[model samples]
Target: MKMKKLLISIVILVLLGIASIYIPIPGYMVITPGEMLNTKEMIQVDQGTKSKGDYYITSFEQGPANAISYLFSFTGIIKVEPMPPLDEQKMDVEKGKADLENSKLSAMTAAIRKAGKDVKYEHKGWEVLKDDTKYGIKKGDLLQAIDGISLKSSEEFFLPDLIKYYEKKKVGDTVTYQILRGEETLEVKTKLVEQNGQKIDDLNLRLSVKQKAEFQSPVKVNFKKLDLGGPSAGLMMTLDILDELLPEDLTKGNKIAGTGTISADGKVGIIGGENYKVLSTIDTGVKVFFCPKENAKLAQETVKKYDIKVKVVPVATLDEAVEYLRNMK
Candidate 1:
């Protein structure tokens, strides 16, 4: 009888321990180093040349935190943060997907133009980021027009245009918006608010609907279906596209890794998780890692903190990265 009771107690403890590892604790997320993917395998440019060298994009894993992961955060190898509200999380996921799509488009345009080619773009519509106004506007709604003004135009939408449209109007002015939700087209009314001597509303049209791009060059670029979704790989993808389009070998037969968001005009934007990305390159034979100039300090600090054996190069533009590779010893 004594032996059976002891065995039962041990089993209960074991089951509890396993449960703690698998069950996620709400309101927190765990972030850890992820993978480094070679862009050569991920991107294919038709009518473009293949290079002997390789370009890698770094990534990090994030998910709801479990009890075991929360405990592991103390070791400094991982990070845990309080999760935002559920609605915000959903909005963030949509934004992330949109950003990934935009990144690919921007990379292709930037690379093609840098190679002396032309590319055209059309603004499709506006993506609703917030719907906190008194109106019934909901997040993820496709904003088609405002006060009969079509959002879909040849020119890109800018904040100044939005401001200018509402400039003559005073606070408490109401505007009608035509939005598309699924297959349904609905009209919603929103009221403007005063902020810093400017009249604005929470229509949240800043996040543009995905733009359509047409490349004039014979070279066509397509990305393989990737599990990751974010804009941080934009810079690396642009570099890889350039490598494929140009006759010159940008990699110089060396393994290079990087992370940063690339704009259509070739500017490199800042990204999160630079430190963990640096840690992910350990023992990967990556000679050089490029990051946005804004992240350079933290990336270099992470390299020093972990004694990583890679050089960290900070670049503000695609031209800077190209010039550095051209002059690389």
Candidate 2:
């Protein structure tokens, strides 16, 4: 009788522990390593398309987790969100994200066009809309600053810089911004708030910045929607597009995976979930994983932590990535 009781108790505890991972704490979100999307297959470049080697985009699978997985997240192997992510903060989360995705595809198209032909991609700033926009920011205005810092015209790309400033701020804080409408720059201020312990942008306006791409030999690039949001895939998309547009096989017959947000000038910006993406890339038989130089320390740490056998290459710009792949032997 005593042995049977002990076994039953153990079983009960085990089941309860397993159940903990899925338990939804109100307002909290879960983040886990997501799978690899062989993005090359998803993108169709109009001119020349060839399957030389694999080029992939990786994302982190996010959702509620079990107790075991929850505890493991603390080891830095996985991430958990304390707040509703930016894309999900609004009711039109999918719509907002889709618009952003379109911008990324546009950016990629511009990058490739500039490499192969003469082209310039231009976007002044994200237009501010009144509907559902937080912080009382009016419509038809351009966001030019955050926290009183001006996103000067001389600054490279406003989107990435705009994102960087907002991310540095926490909930319950006050944020001030400079908006541009025509020739006037006006200051707007708002208070920050938290959703499930994650700080959200005070201004929740869906941004579809006005962009114009100029190219003589325009490449009509179409990206298949895989329900993935975020600009992290920009670099890979640019490289893959270049691979197709250029005669030389950029992959050099080896699988390559990368994560970064690309600017019009081809500068690669930092991205989240590099470690998670790298881990998934490792499983995909990729010979090289490109990481943004801006996150050099994290990339180096991830490589050192896992003692990753796969070559981890750090790149600063789209041209740098192209040059490295071009020289691959």
Candidate 3:
């Protein structure tokens, strides 16, 4: 009878463990340091733009976590964040990837233009790239406005700017969108909905860049990462493109890493997680890490806190980075 009780207890304990692992928790996500990926392994520039040396971009892995997994974080140094409901998170993830692809194209345009070559852009209307059945927004319709806000098409509207306006909006507000279908523009209004612990757009639409770039002499670039999202990789990607176009290598025989948002004007904008990136450099075989001028303080603090051997170089523009590398003895 004692052995029978012992076996039953073991079965019960196993079931309990399984339940703990599968149970979902509310309002939290797990964020951990991701790997330092080398850009050379993933980026392909046309032979006209190909250069020498390696560059790395850093990322932090983040996703939804269960109660048991969240609790396990206390045992180590993983970060837990109270995210928007699960459905909202899913939508944001989808939107983030689309925005990232647009940003990468913008980065390529900036890099090729910076090489003193002529670049051309084509205006592709906000063609229905993503179909949302709820708002009667069909595939192939061109988006023209949102809630009376006219989206500019100078370079075929910055898609993220339009998306940000909606994402920051109140959870239950109604939004009116103007879309063009079959040569006629129409007003379509939709309301956001919250249910089952999630709130998502009633007019769930996926939009992308309508602007395609053409460069004289054609220095085409392709950036591929299945799991990568966001525009943080912009600066390194721009730099990599520029490096390949020039005869000299900017990496200068040392491993380099950086994170920043790149603008079409060649400016390096601030990005999040500079502290975490600084910490990532320790024993990672990197000698120099470049960051935006705005993130210099945080990078310095993290470096000093951990006594990392890497040098933190702050640059404001692509030209500054190139000149610094050129003059380096």
Go through the candidates in order and give each one's C-alpha lDDT.
0.80, 0.67, 0.70
Model 1 segments more than 4 A misplaced: 121-208, 212-215
Each prediction's RMSD over C-alphas, in Å, is 6.7, 4.8, 5.6
Over 210-317, each residue of candidate 1 has an lDDT whose tens digit, in order, gives 554443545689889876777899999999999888989988999999999887778887777898898899999998999988789989998998889999999988
Best of the two (2, 3) by TM-score: 2
List, residue by residue over 214-255, the lDDT tens digit for candidate 3: 434366776667468766787888878888777777777777
Clashing pairs in 3: 50-244, 51-244
Give the Å shift of residue 219 in candidate 1: 2.5
User: What would the TM-scores of all predictions be?
Assistant: 0.75, 0.76, 0.68
The order of the candidates by lDDT, greatest first, is: 1, 3, 2
Q: What's the ranking of the predictions by TM-score, best on top?
A: 2, 1, 3
Residue-wise C-alpha lDDT for candidate 2, range 155-230, written one tens digit per residue: 1333555556656876667777687777997877666665433444545434433332233336677777656776
Off by over 4 Å in 3: 1-27, 48-52, 66-77, 122-128, 131-217, 224-226
